[model samples]
Target: MKRPAPRTATTRHVTQINRTAILDVLREHGPLSRRDIQQRTGLGSATIERLCSALMEEGAVEAAGQVRQSVGRPSTLLRFASSARAIMAVDVTEYTARGRLVDLGGSTLYEESHTFALEGQDAGAARIDGLLGLVDRLASPETGVTAPIVAVGITVPGIVHEGVVTKAVELDWQEVPLADIVSARSGLPILVENDANATAYGEWHSGALANAHSAVALVLGARLGAGIINEARLHRGHRSAAGEIGFLLTSSASFSRYFTEQGDVDSTLAAQVLPFAAREGLHGKRIGPAFRAMMARCRAGDSEAEQARDEFFDSIALALVATSVVLSPQVIVLAGAFAQYSEESAEQLTRRLVGRIPWVPRIAVSDLGFDAAITGVSALTIEHARSATYLA
Candidate 1:
């Protein structure tokens, strides 16, 4: 590989730092006068003006209005030009790929979801084609994007290491160079991340867990996983697989089988629990109905359903407590469909965790919903775009 130097690395780093400081301040605090920016960042007046001028030319900043002063001249207020560039993020799940095109401020400009069924012998290649098709659609003009698309961030359900998806049993993918492939197809920079980790990051960055010192996003969708945050930073673990909490042997459900590629959620939910619920006439279709049925029955004083509810929630709390005891986040956010019953689920887990640990973190429902990965990837791509602002 050859180095592509638009500027010396030292100069580029300092430039990015200065730009990030000004842009971040404007972004976080909204519109501000140059004096306010100077006070906020401690950068000199001349430096601020020069950078602001460059940013305005690059469409990254714009004049908001002028602040009328009691004395002397009026000060011009500048705002971060959130719509200057588009950031596209796609989150790949087991049966669907949900994506969005957002501005620098993380506001959705375009959004679409494609539900796909990948089967047969050539599933992996088909998956890639389908995914790339989605990428193309996201970048299409129907998204109403007039600005340059800086980069695309992808989040997938798997153990993502570097730019490769090491394992995604749901997608039946292993060791796929997803980032390079997407980048090649789109001719743009690509950032790939594990879905759970991305969800945790999204929650921490701008959703339910925002401002918390530490937090964990326990994803209880069709599968079980987690995104861990410690000291306001993601803990990607060895090989960036830090929050694979599904494999923990904390499930209280007695199942005849062991974990397969899908991990414990496979054995616990799809195989053992749902099957039992179906056979026992708890639900006609799936886990959501089944869980609701059980809860309703248990509330109606059905002994069997009550006991079943206790065991199911105990299993979940086991997974949560197992991760919490180690990471010790200040809060744990529940992500996925099961989170719709957040209060009920929180009650179940909270009551079950009694005496299990010294202190129980606050349990919160995910405000980002299913698009957490999209929000998270937006965060990642925003950082990448900022870093490469003038460096590239």
Candidate 2:
């Protein structure tokens, strides 16, 4: 399908709309020329030029450089200022971690991560303090940043209700005021999201499904989670657990159980999957080395590891296939640990998925790898920061 060029208009109301549209273009694809903006947005050349002049005057954007085409005169390119402002992106998931300083245009400046053991109430408190420390250090005037963290985007496992995390099954958190604590400590407007939903939103806004109207993301890490986006709004149902697909409980009792039969979840599993978990300041279980070795062997092509991977992914496929039937999204991106396993499983799942749904969403492994959460979280921060422009 052909995308129409941004509509160009001479009216003041249309110019206001174009202001938001121009920003979206630069945000999604930066350092664009006046011509590039006109093409992507379908706006008239004159209107684009006018808006660019006004935005420059308002300090919302700046002229970056001139673009030399293959066989034409250089075109002046405009881009969001790198120093426009910055936001904090905090990803606190069950299997990985990150805290980054991101700019309004979604560029990450600095980030850090490490392992952790977070479970129950006391652990949550400890994790919160640790995350605060990272924020303080990053936001310190000594860091040489152009701006402090004006907004925050955080992702976590389990169900988040308003600011309270009602049920983080993996973290064993119930009715916890997570957002309040983080907001108080950081002194920034905070937007907390379920990890999967955040990832899906990030992928969509980042143009992963550039051609599609909507997409779904299935993140397989320490546990399975899914996120859905249609018409650009996150489908967080009334309870705000819209993407909590982990608790769906496969028929395979073992697959459904979070811990081993012995009731022990090895720290290695935590290390292998959640090595950076603590650094994000999220609270969750910590697996030992034994679990890490097992996961490593699985990724390294060990036969036993292969079998485990196959079994785990096969069950995961069933859930995914089922979801495809319901949502029928344009694509389903597999992220986290499972992305490694998807190359082998995509075919199997596709073959078995025939006749199940009228249309099956294209299944592909996430190309973003471990950085999906961070990228998504960063996107979230930028989205909130630009809300004023969009809403106006």
Candidate 3:
């Protein structure tokens, strides 16, 4: 505290920026030529060469191949030396707990999941145990990782404030030091993030919205969670819980009430609304399983089934209309188990936007499937690692 770091701040800032740019290049278009990297980064050729050499020495990158497009001399292609490093990601949701071992390139090397009751007392402990089990599995001699574990990323649903679980209503977690527990187990650095934010990061990093610089990802599942990426950086507002859009009061008073009311409805049944739209049917398919089954039955030309689907589309349109009025983001990405339902939901959202708003955010479904959370956590870990290295 004795002002011992006068020039350290500037040096650290520069280092962080350099490293961030390097990592960003590798993430965007990896397995690149040194010249290509230099061109993309706009760094001096000598500096790029030095950085690449240093990174290679650190086992963060490796020569993958040579690009021989030009006649003069082929350029050696560099790829993230994935085998040389490892990171662990823990994804905790209301219905399941999953952990993945990822390489430096964001590729998942191994994954394991478990269904555990996250209600009542030992929930937090159980989750920690599961995560430890995952680390052990990946660190064992048989795993054959060249660089071992460098960091760990833990993602959980609910309001997370600086490594502490503030209010995970679904999991009944409160003020749990999740990051500390995981760090104690791994004896390595740990990063904790809201699961929704993680999903947004994943989508922004590797899913359908990867190219968008400004986007909002609304994850609809056990609870609706929103994560916003502004100018390619995760924006965690003042309290680190900035993207809690589900709590935004909709027609049913609160999102909890809205989602709760739909608990009894089977999502699979709800999906049929898409096909029904094709036939322009909606009267009988008001909302329920029988309506869903009827929609399915209409493949043979049952008019009523088609009508129910139309009504279903109308409901989705209303939701998207509300979302558009609020965020007005460049793009809106949907990622969750429920998102896998028929294209009707996405299509309906688009169709409703036609005349509803002067401008509409492009909506798309996440393509990363199960890997989005893990991928986002890995990206966050990579950024955190760069920051820590600069400080060192």
**Candidate achieving the largest TM-score:** 1
Candidate 3 lDDT by residue in tens digits, 229-262: 8887788888797876544443543444444222
Which TM-score value belongs to model 3? 0.70
lDDT of each: 0.80, 0.68, 0.69
| Candidate 1 lDDT (Cα, 0 to 1) | 0.80
lDDT value, candidate 3, whole model: 0.69
Residues forming the 10-long window of minimal summed lDDT in candidate 3: 260-269
Where is model 1 more than 4 Å wrong at Cα?
Answer: 1-9, 68-73, 117-121, 250-271, 276-306, 390-392
Tens-place lDDT per residue, model 1, 1-392, is: 99986755686678778898998899889699999999999999998999999988988889999997559899999998878888888888766788788877777888888877565647677778888999998887877778788989999888898899999876779999999999999999899998888999999898999998889998865567889888878889888978887777643563645665756643454443464466557543244445655666666887876677777887778777777788888999988756657788887888888788988998988898876877888898878876666443
Error of 1 at 327 (Å): 1.7
Query: Which of candidates 1 and 2 reaches a greater TM-score?
Result: 1
TM-score of each: 0.84, 0.69, 0.70
lDDT of 2 at 312: 47
Instruction: Provide the lowest-lDDT 10-residue window in model 2.
Output: 260-269
Q: After superposition, how far is residue 324 of candidate 1 from its true place, in Å?
A: 2.3
